[model samples]
Target: MIQQFRRFCAGLIVSLSAFGGFAGAAENADLLLSGPLFPAIETFHLENGMQVGVVPDARATFVTHMVWYRVGAADEASGKSGIAHFLEHLLFKGTEKFPGNAIDRTVKAVGGNHNAFTSHDYTGYFQKVTREHLPLMMEIEADRMMNVDFNAADVDVERQVVLEERARGIETSPRAQLSAAMDLALFKNHPYRRPIIGWRNEIESLNVDEIREFYERFYTPANAILIVAGNVTLDEVKSLAGKVYAPLQNRAPAYQPERPQEPDELRMRQVITVRDPKITNESITITFRVPSFRTGLPGENEAIDMLSEILSGTTRSRIYRDMVIDRQIATSAGAYAGSGARDDTTFALYATPKGEVTLEEMEKELFAAIDRIARDGVTSDELDRARKRLFANAIYAQDSASGLANILGRTLIVGNRLEDIRSWPDRLRAITPAQIQAVAAKFFDPDKAVIGLLRRPIDFETASLKKDPA
Candidate 1:
């Protein structure tokens, strides 16, 4: 297992190890192990306002070309929810230069792959292909950047797909339902409260012109990030981009409208419960609104990242060890810090009870664990372990070209600097126990939290047995 993990990282790394322009060399071992992630990545901007990040990894044969637009579900016009996501589906339908799925078919013909996704803060598209096909990828992407051509019929077809997706993903799944409810509770005024997939009724109402208008508004050179990662150099990528992307004009506003901010004070704590007949596992989630990397003070985001690692990043982590192994009240327990968003992010804790343990029992233990961490702070040993675990994960993530591109693109689009990503190791290492405790005590206030319980209907087991008994 260890060897396989290394292989994946190394395979991914062979591409990423080149980010620092080091490639895989015995001479660079110490630097590779100790230095910042992507130590040598090159970032620049076109005259047209498109930002570019180039990570050259010669160990890999192909490059992962990614274009990230600084727009997503949160940026949608009010009542036009899901239009951002809906447009992601339609972009592939056609473009003026390469219409009718020609771009996708062309990539496959060359044994390459392509896909796109939309999120709360951004939308992105990527393709992986050999060096020889790099310019081809750039050409088609640049074409679509300004020239997506979808008809009304295409919009109708894709709208139904989005609606069905919401039905299948949000309405039918208890977990998704719980998450949506929690977000609505956690973010009262901020657009973050809106689901990325949009509300079902709004999705149904989304029209063709809305999709076209949204695409034209947000898909500008200024609002996009072009990331080229793999066995390629800055000069090669720059040369190709100069030909393909340089001519594109910026059509977006000089400044995007500011997102609505969450109020300074949260007046109440919210507890939401969702009981689904199909749910077999009962779990509770406690989420607190916290500052994202962009909004956090110096060392705040890093400390939160460390706090989450110490809490439940591994099986040996505090929450897991205490709840699942020592107390034996939970089948699973963990906490995560969402430090990546453009605005405020989240720090969440969740646990599933073992056997007949009540959600109330699990909730009590979970909150106590968080309280203990906030009050006592982590020991030096715990701090050391967490730093190592987080650093190791960072190292592993750096081994893939696509992974490097994702980290670079996502960080850039969310109003964070490239140095913020490159300096992650040093920042993570610099975090102290007191800093972690400070964020813990500060963000996890009960008055500002959202708690969710998802479980089977009250008599689900009884009903199941009554219906199936022989």
Candidate 2:
């Protein structure tokens, strides 16, 4: 049973290890992994300024369509915190052709799933269904593009729903509280500090007209990108897009508001801690202010990604092996970097304290691991293993059309080009251990980092979970 569990964990590591530049060269092509994430992706613009990216895959049967709007929580004005997310919910309420639940009912009737998400830099809606339903998906999305409407009743109802959602998703969780406070310390004046869900006070003030104005402002064809991946041709998607989205004239503003930059003094450091009975083990996370894929140097972004993987991509990774297994201080350890945001990115590492292991000790050990990387740099063997896992996962991701589609959509929304996707594998191979260490030494400075803790109160007892018993 132990060996079986280890095998299962090993398989997950092989399959799930991935990064922004994960895709690799085709099979038997000298490189370790298989073909590119999307071998051929064609992009074109409609007359109304909607950008469309089509990735053709013969192996895929169904199609995945994603529409990315260039506005999200950060775009909301000072007073209207949650309006962007509220508008996202309201969009589904109804339109002239597809009234309340009509669009959802149709998609369900066709046996498809559809949903939307609001993020710090963008809002997106995605649907995956049969190839025959592609036209209907585009048509309904195009309809909502210009025709969504809501009455007073709908507005009040959704407002309450959004508020209730906030209570469930954020307010009730101690970890969420720590995250919010940590960001507040991390970004200072930057809009990224504002929670994606907005504050309860601000959300209460969100009304129909406010959301309508915001919708009219940012929800234009020019400010959106459409990504379609499936067993389909570029010409078919282009023809369908021309028939549906071509007529939408650009109504969005010509100038985007330049968000306030994080002050250099934001180069400062701080710590935040939250306590709750619900949380037993002490949780600690260290976050650094980093650069996004577009904002950072080309090789630098990929290097940061590689650095994260080498630090803790799996159970065999440095932090887990050291802090969790060898030191027996932390019950769990992991690290990840988000390279998709527009203005900046965040690279964070987190761990939970094992029984009788103080949070302070765990924090010290975590930094010590980071310090070792900066001082000695990584070995070629470690780098090679990390790259292999990365390359392998990229090959595996090819089997999912929606996953490829998401890569294209997220890449474009964060201000990268289509060619970036094509060149991902090449760029990743170019990242050296020196480059990884460079990011480590540069971004891991204590001055520019934020540390957050989900500390447990004295006498708090952890639930039925062990601390690296293996």
Q: What is each predicted model's overall lDDT from 0 to 1?
A: 0.79, 0.77
- Candidate 2 local lDDT, 1-470, one digit each (tens): 00111111111111234433433432322264434445677899887778899989889878998898888788889989988788888888879999989989988899998998777777888888999999999988988888988677898998889889889878999987887887788788888888888999998887778888888889889889999999899999989999889987777753264798887765777888888888867789988888766678768877877787888877778999888898788889978777666776577888898888777777788787778888999998888777776766676666777877876776777567877766667777788889888888888887767889887665423332354334
> Per-prediction TM-score, please?
0.90, 0.90
Regions more than 4 Å wrong, model 1: 1-33, 254-257, 460-470
lDDT of 1 by residue, 247-310 (tens): 9888885336489898877536899999988888889999888877778899997787778778
Stretches > 4 Å off in candidate 2: 1-37, 254-257, 459-470
Q: What lDDT score is found at residue 109 in candidate 1?
A: 98
lDDT of 1 at 460: 68
